[model samples]
Target: MSTDKKRFSADGPAPRQRFWKEAGVQETADGFTITLDGKPVRLPGGNPLCVTARPLAEALAAEWAAAGLDDPKGRFTPADLPLTRIAGTKIERVRPEREHIIATLADYGAHDLLCYRAETEGPLTVRQAEEWQPWLDWLNERHGITLRVTHGMMPIKQPEPALQRLRTLLATRNDADLAALGVAVPALGSLVLGLALADGAITPAQAVAAASVDERVQMERWGEDAAILDRIAAMNEDVTDAARFMELGRG
Candidate 1:
């Protein structure tokens, strides 16, 4: 396939490419590889677009096949092929910028979700402490990283040793998991949730619920309007997608 015809690009949006008529997977020496129109798909850089996991390769091939066969008005968007998009990011972006991705995600630890609390003593504060403190305690017990919690929005600086410990843990991951972290950390606004998801300590649903605990409390105190409900739905989808990507990326 021509580079211009590729549906997803690493840097930004691209013009719509012609969708293939068929898709399948090839068992290559490297691993399971996706094939479009009976030929192996190539990345924009001309490298073979390959996946190491069979389930992921099948999912990617299925996405391409669905894209090709389902578009009459050419309505197939990047959102329709999240697996392929994430795979592209893993190969083209994350692999090349592993250290930068690690550093950036690790920096989220300094101001993680657990570090910030509601200002006043209310249901929100109690809920925040109840929902968030366990994860903080977990980190303390498991990793010896004692993060300080503060009431209010002001940034509290975490200890340098804790930050370095997190940076070391993030550095140990391979490209695919790191790429998943790049999405998960920002999506949930919590490095602890991302690490929990990465280490199989929590499910995506639990992560989403924990990440939105404040919002959930607000909804309970007042009432959830359509806008907040819609946002929660979207966030759930994004977090679930990242979680699935992490799972499939695992061999």
Candidate 2:
């Protein structure tokens, strides 16, 4: 499979403003990544379900474009999209670009479409890891998708030294404290917050609780009171494992 991705950067010339159409389907390690606009967003690999869903997605995308739902950026929300009934499940997607469709697929338990083509790959960026974090959480917590984030099972089960370091950072109100631990407050908190947010919308309080030890840890640190940390850990097991998003499961 061969394909291409097209895009118009915000700083590009006027003639370069046009969106590139879908072109190739190249063979990827896990499966063939559908090429659109030259960029290859990962498509499901190896699973027959993912293999079969390709044509259907493409055909549906064209229909969406015809219906005026495909914006220049290749994103268009429609009142209703097509649905294909598979043997035991129904395949439905939010029509248009890669991200939304992949998200939709994950929401439905379509695991095949979510792999990153591990065999033929590129460096996974921090930003890409961030994007995939929520989905990982969803898969783990709700669907029981056990993935690795560090040396063992993901989403560190104990905060331990990391938690102690994080609390120290909060105590001093210093960025250096966070840097010393290898992550900033916001970034570290964001990962924990992402797990707490899995059930629904996230709140700053939840992020704060997960990021820090607990409200009472400052003035009163007790072994029994460690349950607060336990609660936070139960919600999100990882403390030192930033890269292991699979622990969070799918979302």
Candidate 3:
């Protein structure tokens, strides 16, 4: 991937100028659409921001409605509306540039978080192996890709064949699903966790928890602090939002 191709944002384009008296959802013959001041909402790409799932449409409408309350200036940021941000990216970025996204995701598998373990012999090592080994085994059985587990942070030379198989599996996802996977992959720092979520093998909450196993184990040993706990809570929300985004896209 080119350096420019690798530098993509999930937020996609900047937030549109808000100029609506009211925001709501409208059901159409095709599906559901969000409306601003009785007019249908349009994505940055100039296409109608419509979805087949009523829940997703409603969620998007609600995001717009909330923006009205929060910003009296009629200005909103992408950070304020997670669902709308994702929907916009699905249309503007992910759909148009999918191959690059696939390559970016496949790169994560080369040095997957699950394939690295602590060198020291202690509870943390045991915890990592116990939580990580099953998914490694699952990959081996399912795709004949056996990732080597290393005891240190040094780079591991993963087999090119295994990496190719992982990339092949990633290519099977549609744009919306791929967008969600892209978010989950970097957030969790585990390509396997991202794949598990995409494959419907694990819930978003499970993915978040699994990715933070080492941190949680350390928290357990040293007692939870307020700052770390708050950070974890925010991360959990982001991961769950990505998972929900994928589910809505499927609908």
Error of 3 at 153 (Å): 0.5
Q: In candidate 1, what are the lDDT values of residues 1-251, reduced to their tens digit? A: 55334444555564355566788999999888899888898888777778789988988888887773444555456767778877887888888888888889988898898789989998888888888888888778777778788999998988899899999988888887887777788888999988888888888888888899988888887997787787777777777787888888775
Candidate 2 lDDT, tens digit per residue, 1-251? Answer: 11112222334322212244553444545433434455553323322222223443353334323432234444422211211111002112211232443333222222211222223223332323444455556545663444334321123332344333323323332111122112212233342333333333444354434344323343253445565655555334332222121111111
Whose TM-score is higher: candidate 1's or candidate 3's?
1
Q: Which is superior by lDDT, 1 or 2?
A: 1
Cα error of candidate 1 at position 196, Å = 0.5
TM for candidate 3 is 0.83
For model 3, the run of ten residues with the poorest summed lDDT? 3-12
lDDT of 2 at 189: 37
lDDT of each: 0.81, 0.32, 0.80
Q: Give candidate 2's TM-score.
A: 0.21
Root-mean-square deviation (CA) per prediction: 5.1, 19.8, 6.7
Compared with the true structure, what per-residue lDDT tens digits does model 3 show for residues 2-72?
A: 53222224444444467777888889986888998989988867978877788888888888888735444
Position 132, candidate 3: lDDT: 85
TM-score, cand. 1: 0.88
